[model samples]
Target chain A: MSLDAPTDHTGLRVMGAEECLERLASVPVGRIAFTGNGKVAILPVHHVVKGVDVCFRTSGGSKIEAAADHASVGFEVDSYDPSTRSGWSVTVSGIATVVDDDGLVVELEASDPTPWTMGDRSREVWIRIRTDELSGRELTRT
Target chain B: MSLDAPTDHTGLRVMGAEECLERLASVPVGRIAFTGNGKVAILPVHHVVKGVDVCFRTSGGSKIEAAADHASVGFEVDSYDPSTRSGWSVTVSGIATVVDDDGLVVELEASDPTPWTMGDRSREVWIRIRTDELSGRELTRT
Candidate 1:
């Protein structure tokens, strides 16, 4: 069950799909990338893994609103250790859509993945990225 | 001169342009997001802040290659502390293009911000993203 493995010559290894999904579910934060108003945009977001999908709450904004309308979006999360120069990065690309189901929204809120910053970021809208394509890479010193 | 500031009621503050630039230059790694071949893509990339522009090296690949052809791209770097629930995120959006200047390519490679994955990723092609718009936000707990 250990995700760690002996490093090879290149010190880099492609992570398996299961490991990628495990890492995605374990991380509470990631960056969501989407094209908004004809511009590429990336924003740090607090997220929760629901099954195989990634969901995050947002107060209405041009970027998140645009992502809801866009056909495709990118999500990335990583853990790196500077001292050891080791870590892994996981990226998921999929369709992003608004989660309008009332019951599900309430259920998600119970997980407490809301924005860490204290403010009126009530996050009325919830967006979920369905995992169409998932990939990851890990690096470690031998 | 201190990037650190007292946590306000909102627990959030807008960072000044100079401070944003300073943090970006100090970080050696970031995520690059772009729309390539009609798909959203985000990849971890090691970049150097050269003046107001962000530069990185890439070997010929569909994702990075497509980014070079795209008109606009997104770059982001962030640092978060889980225990303190504090962090800052900086994002830059601009046009991306291949750097064909032979002399300049040599100078950039000398900085050694290339891929950490050891391999024959010669990364002869140098890509530069012109920072047309830059923004950042910080979060802290009182």
Candidate 2:
């Protein structure tokens, strides 16, 4: 562990896969980063950990369009406390695809992932981010 | 305010530039999204708003490298309350560059932006994100 690698420092701990999922599942709101209109855009969404996949709901907008386009996406949920300088952030990097299958959509909707904007529940599109690249970091006082 | 446009809805309000910056300046920590290694990466960092430029510190790593690479970056600051089902998110979509000028670095450091992981202040590289495409959305009950 070199000094240049801060993750190797005593104050910061690199979280394992299980911890990452736990932190993610604990939060209902997370941000999604995607490339749209030739620029990167990040927006907040409500997500639920359905099995190993992080799922969210989006209506007719860039998010749904990103899903329809199957764009490369990054989903992140984080918590930070400036006074204590302690926090945890989990990021899921993968592709966003729309779930159109009626059976799957019905099942995913059963989980009732709240869309940030909150609109017609039946009109919402289910976007599932399936990825193996799950990483997180926890910060603590040295 | 059409049915297709969710922003014009009764609950969600599109924030102006002034409000966006205010939301950003009020928060000490924000997440940055950038493209590195052919993938979009989002990480949380302590930030300070310097006029139109939002700045943060990073050591010799992917973040600094992203600055060196002059990457297209997106910075987001948000707050959400699930109980009220309300939240506000501000996003800055722009390019990230390194502030290597000694005079400027010293001046920026005078503000004393605490890096997420407390490290040697002098050793950390300052990354400035400049963007005109600032947008935000505030969500409340309908």
| lDDT tens digits, residue span B45-102, model 1 | 7788888889987766546866687479999999988777788999999999998898
Output DockQ, candidate 1: 0.57
* Model 2's DockQ score: 0.54
Where is model 1 more than 4 Å wrong at Cα? A1-11, A121-123, B1-11, B113-115, B121-123
Cα lDDT tens digits, model 2, B1-142, are: 2344447433577887888889999988998887766677788888899887898888756454554457778889999998988888999988888887889888887897455675554466889898868988887665
Q: Report DockQ per prediction, comma-separated.
A: 0.57, 0.54
Q: What is the C-alpha lDDT profile of model 2 across A45-122, one tens digit per residue? A: 888887768887777554445544666788899998878878889999987788778898878777774455656655
Give TM-scores for every candidate, taking all chains together and pairing residue i with residue i. 0.88, 0.88
Error of 1 at A28 (Å): 1.8
Worst 10 residues of 2 chain A by lDDT: A1-10
Clashes per candidate, residues 3 or more apart or on different chains: 0, 0
What does the lDDT read for residue A130 in candidate 1?
85
- Candidate 1: tens digits of C-alpha lDDT, residues A87-128: 789999999988889888888888775467665566457788
B-chain TM-score for every candidate: 0.85, 0.85
Q: Which window of 10 residues has the lowest lDDT sum in candidate 2 chain B?
A: B1-10
> Which residues of candidate 2, in runs, are more than 4 Å off?
A1-11, A61-64, A120-122, B1-11, B119-122
